[model samples]
Target: MSTFGQYFRVTTFGESHCKAVGCIVDGCPPGLELTEGDVQPQLTRRRPGQSNLTTPRNEKDQVVIQSGTEFGVTLGTPIGLFVANQDQRPHDYSETDFYPRPSHADWTYLQKYGVKASSGGGRSSARETIGRVAAGAIAEKYLRLVYGVEIVAFVSSVGCVEMPFIAQMRNDRALEPEFFQLLDSITRERVDADMVRCPDKDVADQMRDEILKNKEACDSVGGTVTCVIRRVPSGLGEPCFDKLEAKLAHAMLSIPATKGFEIGSGFAGTAMHGSVHNDPFVNSTVDPQGKPNLRTATNFSGGIQGGISNGEHVYFRVAFKPPATISQAQTTAQYNGQGGILAARGRHDPCVVPRAVPIVESMAALVVMDAVLAQNSRSKSASLLPAVSKSNPLMYGQPPSS
Candidate 1:
């Protein structure tokens, strides 16, 4: 259950209060130059104590490379990474002994394992994502160097405040022009410049203040993160089962507190007629052989059509529920069906969207990376066969009869 991806496989380990938390990344191509420097910055961004909007848990989240590299180059073997749990405070969670803590993982984990971790949320904690972030950085490095892929995610909303796309989403599902431009030109540097990690400076400030307000009230709030992957090549997905958007949804929803997942025109496009919802093609690309390529007139498909990438910017949004471990008192049931008021004690984010930004981006990289490897395998194998001629009924290039 711990492992993910078919080709670019990764297995994560460790609990919230464990000695260390990390992952083993398998199947990375050899000779790719990698080091702690390539991975640490994202871990640092995912770390706690970043700002007033997050938990006060002062973890530096320092990462170390344990194996699978020789002189800072990946050897195409399993890469082991670990980050010390230096600032963990398990005692703070003692209140969970009496009650399961509503909306928290305490009750279900105990039911599932017949036992639970001694402290914190155990494997249920967001801390478990350190391994994901680490593995993703490696995948990102490969994608970046070889394919020029760029993934950028930002806090699109915090509680009621939303980025313009979400704010004005209508049944027609035609998002704003500015939203498209934002996807075309946004950068991580611009995203990180804001206090709340939202690229729009004005929205970031308001989101920050709102989170501080929730923090002061000992409550938690929910929000969403939007991610865009650019320069991903066409035909990178499995059909019928692992559609590109389906895999993206699975990966994004796997994060600790994710509540929902939607890709380009999601939900909002449902009300539109096919005439408005369909993406029309335009001849806008040229191959190295000087052949023209078909491009989408509108990206309503979100860079994917028929379960494959369409060589356009792939964009999606993930919604995170409020951090379940709030310090506020609440009436809830105990493990024995007894009822009582519980005031939980733990360090959790008032708003998770800012920190979830990197997690979203990393998971996107992993999905795209896995898809790349799968497609590459197929392409290589197909190259060995004779090309299909127009006379063949099974020709892949032939469109279906109307």
Candidate 2:
């Protein structure tokens, strides 16, 4: 289903090359402050032509809020958001619909629906994600305010290039924004100094040389993104039906061109014994002033236990395949019910890892916000008896006077 989440449902619509693409967010709580300005920055981050490393398709991706709010606060109604398609090259894709672009949804969409949008891979295009990013930005703001949750994602690999471990790169004394700025600067320098988004200076140079060579030949490549989430609370997921990691995986896989998803110690956990993979809990103090707390000595389970959050950091990785539209000529069929071959002609990213970083962060925010709302609902239900008892002053910390 296009819609996701039981408590915070979001449905995205529209297509590439269409007049506009957008999303409708249902179940957002009333009184939350929201505006078009809050969602615009994230959209701009994912818009095409932001950098030379991405597709040349230029779209301003200006967002417009249509409904579900009065003044600037949400009204417990469906939130509608739209981003117009400013620059489109429909003629370039006029013939692509009938023949199907290689490694794209053209064939699968046809097999499923018998018809497809004739321009720019239609619904399958990355353009559709504009709505997702916009909605995610709102979700992210809510999550941060309610739960103090923060998510950071970046290009960990492009071709053979990879960044350093996040822990090593962090500064112990710096604040959040400062730390992020440091990281962003380092990352940008590494990417700008070379074509690859890798943080390793030497490896980035090598990756750039290789990508430039391939670009010259009109081919493309793919890479992976690593996301780290901090300060996620405990007990934030339904056990079997709607596990947090499962929900996150579904969201990530739904993004266009995503091929794989893995949480902490994912497939590699198979290589370890149960004893090694387990996270052993220890009695601990919550803080300098708080009561005793539960803590895990290891995070082999990736901050999740029993399909629910364990109040630890959540870490994951997503893998994307090379852009399907390669300059190399390949054999295929034509719209006239005839067989032939065609070389893809268009401006496309040789590697998508750089652009995918923000997309991954956006999807993560949506999942976290949904989980937070579910947890709040459960907390209120479980505390009804306690709340009633507290209201009766006579019963406060006392046995029944029978």
Candidate 3:
């Protein structure tokens, strides 16, 4: 269960306070240009101590490519990646020895594993997501070079503050081309312009203020991350099971602190009648390659219909809860279920939404890359079928009579 994806198998190792944290990415197509430089950008974005809104754990998180490549080109083998932990203060989390933090994984981990790491939350810590972000960077590069696919995620909401564009789009019940155009135009540069990562300056300022206020009160906050995947082909998912949206949900909920997952209209669609919810298909103009495409007048289906992609932009949102470990005193239980007062004393994020943007995009890329490989294999297998008809008889010279 630690590994993710069918075609792109990513196995992560190490823990929060361990000597290192890294991942192994297998099944990548050979001859692709890859290096530590290609994998470091996302790692930097996911690293802590970058801003005041996150924890003050100063870690360089420098990634080293241990194997599976030479001359900066992939060899179609498992690529090993590692990043050493520089600022692991195990003593900061020693309090867990006495009491389990409220709503934290401390108790559940001990119950499931019988023994848990005394420092940090071990595999349950958000630090473990470094592997996903690193491997996802590789998957994203392949998707971009081969399929022209693009994935972007931003802080859609922080606590009660919501981005204006998202709120307006939801209120108007319309997804205009201009809106998608804006969504497509967004770059990591713009999203990272501020510490809050909202891409909307006014709202980002407010979100930052909210986080600061929470930090002032020795508390924390949570919000949502909205991701958009563009230029994905129409037929990249299975039908009966392993639906695209279902896979997306599985990947998202697996992220630490993720509480909810929604695609397209999500929970809001239940309010509208089927007539309004259904996307009316329309003919799409030919692309530069002179290939015909399909378009939908409405995208309530979120670019996927019948559990597969329809060549429209795939968009979704993830809900994250506040950091459970807070400086404020909390009345929680101990390992023996004894109640006591506890005040968590360690570096923690005042708000996680600002840092979750890259994580959401990375997870989305893994899902899409895996689905594309499956679809490609299925198409090749289908193409291998010989021309079969009465003219092409099997076994004997006579065709089977029906």
Candidate 4:
């Protein structure tokens, strides 16, 4: 499971307190321009100590491209990447020596591995995402160069303070027309204008206060990240399973602390009657080649239908739980299976949604890149075969006993 994607495969290594963390990205198209500079921005975004809102673990998170390219061009080989971990505080986790931190991986890690790291969450830590984010950046470069796909994610909420005009981000309520408009226009520049990363200034201020409030109390709060991938070519995803949305959910939930996920209309579509929920198709503005395109009048399907991309903006949300390593005293149990009070001590985000924005964008890029490569491979292979119309009997079912 350390490796992800059948086409653009990525295998990550190292641990939270390890000397370094990084990944080997295979299947990048040879001759595409790439280098450490191409990957470092995202790693910086995912790195700790960005602000008071995040952990004080000061990792420069500077990525070094160890191999897989010659003079900034990928060789289509396994690309080696790594970042040295500069900050270490094994003593901070001394509390974990006795009691397993509540709601953390400490106990389960021991249960699964028969042992666990002495400091930090080890492989389970968000630090592992360094590799993911790094690899994702490479995929993103290719996606943007060939497809002009733009992936953006922002903090949509923090605790009870949801971004204004996002409708509660609940599953039962469909988004307003204006929300879709916002989805089409929102940019990372706007989202990153503030440290909280909320697009709206007022909302970002509120979210900042919320995090600061919890930070001061040695408590934590959870929130949601909304991501939009625009200009995605249609016809990605598998039918039986591995649907685009399913793969998206798989990627999003893989991030540490992610608890929930929803796509496009998501849960809210359920409340509407079929008549109101369905997205009606229409003629598109057409591509530069003047080929007519099909599009939805309303995007309740979230730019995907039948588990495939529909040439609309693909958007979704991921909800994260409060950081489990809150320093507040909690009545929990010891690793010896006894009752006790565990006051966990560590540097963790009071709210993770801000820092999670790039992580979300990176994972989204990975999913899109995988789907693009899968569909491309299939399309190229199919192009060599004789064309068969839908009217052909074999197209309907297995041809008359083979």
Candidate 5:
């Protein structure tokens, strides 16, 4: 299933170390404004070697638009986008081609495909996410313009370093642009500042010092990313299948090295009773001049009820496993099925949480965009159904004249 979506479809192609990786998006509405600039910022955020917290693989990751747009506007056709790979070091991987890295996809890929690309985990590499991020950028633009929906994600936890809860941050007024700027400035002062993207100055400093120590020892750690969505309209998902949360979890888990996912009140909800867990409704208002609004007094349901959006903030967290390519020596087997031990080499991250923030946000955008398109189709279908039924008559108890 390289293809995804029932309405706005996206088909990804190419491999991690192939000539290039790219995507073709079908079903994009025509006349939408788009350009390379729109997608570049996101790709830059996910590109490796940006700082000390990720693999030292430096890729320019410049995007090329091949088709489906003209004069900076979409043409209602399949949009083709690509990114060429530069700075590939096939030699770095030649030695380990025979010995699969522990906790990586090497063994599973071989069992399924008989043969696999020997360099850089081939299709299994996080490099494949370039295409996804590019496609997701376009989807995000559409979502914002049509729905005023906004998605923001950040590294909330790295191993033991956790950012304060949103409530606490808000209460502290830490979200002020100037306050956040000062926090960002302080982080930039450290050599390994990006090891964890936590906004707390003190916690970030501690995280950086710890990461540097681990880097010196050639070890790695894993952590989680929290994504928040605001102003999402109601009725955004299909029932029985393709629930909003289900689609989000599926997209997120597809990312390389992602091991777990939870939507709003996940896992922790087990501690509460039914009454405490439920999102109780309350009388609310939408527009000042319009009718009263609907809302939940508590968001235990995470802005979603019965697999459909209930007009609350939709948020979730995704957990990533430690990068398998640690410098520490480990037990493994040779390609010839001979058992042996090997130490992995190459430029790898001590922690991936900082870099993973953008990837999580991209996947979240992809899921939300698909759900929005599905909702649009359903609305159009319902609008026409009544007229069609009245005209055909056979659609109801009335039959055509004999």
Candidate 6:
């Protein structure tokens, strides 16, 4: 689908190498503060040429708010956002015209549309995500302002260079309270501290070296990104198909090159018994508002149960495949049904997980923001109901007593 979300609909447009790329965001609440500055941080993080590990293409990816805001506040109308493509190198993609890159959308896109963009895989390019990041920025700002939600993502693994704790946590099928605390304290500043974007300095260095090795070999690598959403209120997401995790998976898998999505224990939970996987809830002290809070002794469920948020941290990991285009020579079939050697040429990232951090965070924000809006609409309707009382005949669809 070109558009995403029910309450907070976003329809992105343009493509890689196009004159511009952006989106139209609808259903944004009014009277909230918004500006280009609020959206630029994520775009800058997702932009190319940030480091030697990423693509050398230098795109400032500056966003312009064309409509839907006045005096720095949203007008609750459709928001028009745009970012011009300033670094397009269409000639570099001429090689792909005759033969499709292996494991790329070139073959499938040609089959689906009977036509394809002449350069840079068009919508298949990572550059297409610029619109997503921009729209997500607005969603994120609103989420943070209204619910104090914090979303952070980091490169958890690049090829075999995984975080030290990842294997252990998978084996144990448990997450420590300390880990939650650490996740709570994590900021984009920390995630962006190094080029690899892994919070652990040692692991990040190892990941960097791995990517450099792949780049040197004219190859590419794939990895996973772990994201945590904290301070999300309970009761988001519908019951069946539109469940929170389901919607999250939909949003995540929609991103280019994303191969898998897992929440909480994810695939690891299957190895353990229900006794180990089930989260045991315990009563907790009240919040500042004097409302009692319930917390689990263990978060094996990953802050979600039955596909819904439980007033705990909602976290997930997205698996990304290696960039399909590599300079390495590969023997593949041509459009004429003949065999030939193809060596992709064009600037590409050796490993995409580092840049994918912000994209993951941005998609998560859109999902959560959409859910929040849906819940708000439902809550508003429910709030108008009169209290159940025998004296009130209107409760039974009759006239009230005079």
Identify the candidate with maximal TM-score.
1
Global fold similarity of model 1 (TM-score): 0.96
C-alpha lDDT of residue 324 in model 1: 93
Looking at model 4, the pairs that clash are 171-267, 171-268
| Per-residue lDDT of candidate 1, residues 1-402 (tens digit) | 889899999999999998889999998999999999999999988999998888888989888988899998888889999899998888988878878978888889999989998799899999999999999999999999999999999999999988777857753357878889999999999998975999987888888888989999999999999999999999899998999999999999999999999888888878677998898988866677444568888888899998999899999989999999888999988778989999888788898888988899899999999999999999999989987565654553445675
User: What does candidate 4's lDDT look like per residue over 1-402, in tens digits?
Assistant: 799888999899988888999999999889999988899988877788989999887889999999999988999889999889889778999989999888889999999989999999999999899999999999999999999999999998899898755564364366776788888899888888898999878888898999999999999999999999999989999776899999999999999999999888777777778888888988756667444567888888888999999999999989999999998999988888889999887789888898999999999999999999999999999989987774566654446655
lDDT per residue for candidate 5 within 1-402, as digits (tens), equals: 677676778888877667888789898889999999999888887788987767888888999889999999999999999999887777777767779888888888888989888787888888888888888889889988988877776666666666665334335422334423332233212312444666566767776766667777888877777777777889888887888988888899988888998776677666566876787779866566343468886675667888999988887878888778888878777878798887776667788777777777777888888888788888888977645534565644356887
The local distance difference test score of each candidate is 0.90, 0.76, 0.88, 0.89, 0.77, 0.90
lDDT for residue 81 in candidate 2, whole number 0-100? 95
Model 3 off-target regions past 4 Å? 165-178, 284-292, 387-402
Question: All candidates' TM-scores?
Answer: 0.96, 0.85, 0.93, 0.94, 0.86, 0.94
* Consecutive 10-residue window with the lowest summed lDDT within model 2: 166-175
Model 4 residue 273 lDDT score: 82
Model 4 poorest 10 in a row by lDDT: 164-173
lDDT of 2 by residue, 1-402 (tens): 678767788898888888899999998889889998999977877778866667888889899899999999999999999888878778876568557787888888888998888877788888888878888988988888877877767666666555444333232211234333433344333333433445566756666665666677788877788777788888887879789999899999999999999887767666667876687889766555333458787675767888899887787889998889887888887767688887776667777777777688889988988998888988888877544434454643345555
What's the CA error at residue 273 for candidate 3, in Å? 2.2
Alpha carbon lDDT at 27, candidate 3: 93
Predicted structure 5: lDDT: 0.77
- Model 5, position 306, has a per-residue lDDT of 88
Give per-candidate clash totals: 0, 0, 0, 2, 2, 0
**Which pairs of residues have clashing backbones in candidate 6?**
none
